[model samples]
Target: MLEIKAVTKKFGNDIAVDHLNMVLEPGRVMGLIGQNGAGKTTTFRMILDFIQPTSGSILWNNQPIDLKAKQRIGFLPEERGLYQKITVEEQILYFAELHGMRRSDARQALMEWMKRLDVVGKVTDKVQKLSKGNAQKVQLIASVIFQPEFVILDEPFSGLDPVNMSIMMSEIQRLRDQGAMIIFSSHDMNNVSHISDDLTMLKKGKTVLQGGLKEIRERYGRTKLYIESPLTMSQLRSIPGVTQVTAQENGLLVELADENVGKVIFEKATANGYIPAFSQQPPTLDDIFRMEVAADV
Candidate 1:
C-alpha cells in the first residue's frame, strides 16, 4: 500500500501543495485531477522524492519512502523527454537497467510491452522518426518496461487520436489488473471516468472532492436527464423545474433543479413526439468538475 498523510510542499513563501492525504492499494487506479497550477504535479514529485514536502509524511508499506521505494515506482511526467538519437529499443533498455533489471530481462520485457501497447514501428526506429502519437507510445513503454509495482502517469492521453487513446487505456487497465497500484493525472474526464477506480480533485492545492466514482456521483445527485428528441432548446427550457437545457448530438441534455422534475420533462417530451430515448442519470464527471471547480474561481 502507498499512503500520503497531511503532505504539504512549499516553495519559498508559496504553498504549492497544501495538506493532502491519499491511499492507493494494489489493483486500484487513483485518478488525480485539477486545473492548471492546482499542484497535481507537485504532489507526484513529493511522492517520488524528487522534492521534499515541508510537512507530513509519505510511506510505502509502513516505511518512510526512500531509494528502495523509488525502485518500485515508475513515473511518466507531463513534459515528455526521450533521447531523439537513440533507437526505441535502446532507450527502453536503458531505463529498465536504471531500475536494476538485467539487460536480457529488460530486453524481453520491452519486446512484450511493445507488442502489448501496439507500437507500430520497428524497435530499431529512432524516437524522432516516429509520429507524434507513436512517439508518445514509446515513452509510455519505457516507463513500464520493468512493470513496476507502482506507476504514476501524468497526462498520458494528452495528444492521442481516439484509436491511440483506446490502446493506451487498455494497457493501463491491464497493468492495474496485474496488481500495480497506479496514480495518474489527466485533463480528460472521459478517460479518467473509464479507467479510475477512485478520484481526487484538487483546486488551489487543496482537495475539494475525493471518493469512488459511484460515491461521488451519488453525492452530486441525479439531476441530469438525456432526452432523444428534436425539441428546440427554448422549448425544453420552457418546462417547469428545468434549470438548464443544452443541445446534444442526439437530442438535448436537460438539467433539473430536482430529479422529480424528470417526470414532467418526460411527459412534455412525449407529448411533442415519439421519445426514442430518455435516461435520468447523475451528472457526468465533466459536469461535476466544471460545477465544483468553477465555483472556486
Candidate 2:
C-alpha cells in the first residue's frame, strides 16, 4: 500500500500542494486530475523524493519510502524524455538496470514490451528515428519494463489517437490485474472515468473532490436527462423543477433541479408512445470537473 497523509508542498511562500491525503492499494487504480499548475506534478515529485514536502508524510507499506522502496516504483513524467542518440534497446535496458533488473532479463523484457505496446520500430532503431507517437510508446515501455510494484503515469494518453489510446488503456488494466498499485493524472475525463476505480480532483493546490468514481458521481444526483422524443425544448423547460433544456442533434439535454422530476418527463414523453432514447444519469465526471472549475471562476 502507498499512503500520503496531510502532505503539503511550498516553494518560498507559494503553496503548491495543500494538506493532501491519499491511499492506493494493490490492484487498484487511482486517477488524479487537475488543470495545468494545479499541483498534481508537485505531489508526484514529493512521492518520488525529487522534492521534499513542506510538511506531512509519505509512506510505503507503513514505512518511510527509502531507496529500496523507490526502486519498487515506476514513474512516467508528463514530459517525454527519451535519449535521441541511443538504440531503443540501449535506452530501455539502461532504465531497467537502474531499477535493478539484470541486463539479459531487461533485454528480453524490452522485446516483449515493444510488441505489447505495438511500437513500430526495431530494437536497434535510435530514439530520434521514431515518430512522435512511437517515441512516446518507447518511453512508456521504459517506465514499466521492470514490472515495478507501483506505477505513476502522468498523461499517458496525451498525444495518442483513438486507437493508440485504447491500446494504452488496456495495458494499464493489465498492470492493475498484476497487482500494481497505479496512480495517474490526465486531463481527459473520458479516459479517467473509463479506467479509474477512484478519482481525485485538484484546483489551484487544494483537493476539490476525492472518492470512488461511482460514489462521487452519485453524490451529485441524477440531474441530467437525455431524451430523443417528440417533446419540444419549450415543453421540457415547462416541467416543474426542470432548470435548463437545450436542443441537441439527436436528442435534448434536460437539466433537473430534482431527480424526481425525471418521472414527469418520462410520463409526458411516453404518453403518446415510445421514444427512441431516454437516459437519466448522474452528472458525469466531465460535468463535475467543469462545475468545480467554473465554481472557482
Candidate 3:
C-alpha cells in the first residue's frame, strides 16, 4: 500500500498542496481530480520525490519510500517527453535500462507491448514518425515497460478518441487486476467514474471531497431524474421540490431538491398509466464536480 499522510507543499508563501491524505492499496485505482493549478501535478511530484513536501510523510508499506521503492514506481507526466530523433526501440530500451531492466528483456517486452497496443509502425521507426495517438501509446508503453508495482498516470486519456480511450482504459484495468497500485488525474469525469475505486477532489489545493465514489455520491442523494412523458416543461417546473427542468432531445432532465420529489413526478406522469421512461439516480460525478467547483467560488 502507498500512504500519503498530511502531505503539504509550500513555495515561499503559496501552498501548492495543503495537508492532503490518501491511501492506494494494491489492485485499486485512485482518481485525483481538480481544475488546472489545483495542485494535482504537485501531489504527483511529491510522490515521485521530484520535489519534497514541506511537512508530512509518504510511505510504501510501513517504511518511507526510498530509492529502491522509487524504482518500482512508474510515472507518466502530463507533459509528453520523447526525443523526435530517437528510434522507438532505442527510446524504450533506454528508459527500461534506467529502471534496471536487462536490455534483452526490455527488447522482448517492447515488442510485446507494441503489438498488444496496436501501434501502426515497427520499432525501427523514429518517434517523430508516429501520429499523436500512437506516440501517446508509445509513451504509455514506456511508463510500464518493466511492469512496475505502482503507477502514476497524468492525463492518460487526453486527446484520445472514444475507441482509443477504451483501449487505454482496458490497459489501466489490466494493470490494476495484476495488483499494481494505480493513481491517475484526469478532467474527464466519465473516465474517472468508469475506473476509480477511490476518489479525491481538490479545490485550490485543498481536498474538498475524498472517499469511495458510490459512498460520496450516495451522500448527495439520488436527486437527478430523467423522464419521457407527455408532461410539459411548465408542469415540471410548477411541482414542489422541483429545482430545475431542462429539455433534452429524448426527454426532460429534472433536478429535484429532494429525491422524494421523484415519486411525485412519477405519480403525475404515470397517472394515465404508461410512460416511456423514468430514471431517478444519484448525481453523476460530472454533476458533483461542477457543484463542488461552484460551491467554492
- Please give each candidate's TM-score: 0.91, 0.97, 0.97
Q: What is the per-residue lDDT of model 1 for residues 208-238, given as tens digits with 9 covering 90 to 100?
A: 9899988998887779988896667898888
Task: Name the TM-score of candidate 2.
Answer: 0.97
Cα-based lDDT at residue 166, candidate 1? 94
Off by over 4 Å in 1: 228-239, 266-275
Query: Which pairs clash (backbone N, Cα, C closer than 3 Å) in model 1?
Result: none
- Cα miss at 224, model 3 (Å)? 0.8
Model 2, residue 278: displacement in angstroms?
1.8
Model 2 whole-model lDDT (C-alpha atoms):
0.93
The CA lDDT at 212 in model 2 is: 97
Please say which candidate is ahead in lDDT: 1 or 3: 3
Best by lDDT: 3
**Each prediction's Cα lDDT score?**
0.89, 0.93, 0.93
Q: List the residue pairs that clash in candidate 2.
A: none
Tens-place lDDT digits, model 2, residues 187-243? 999999999999989898899999999999999999999999889999888889999
lDDT of candidate 3 over 206-269, digit per residue (tens)? 9999999999999899999999998999999999999999998799999999999999999999
Which segments of model 3 are wrong by more than 4 Å?
Answer: none
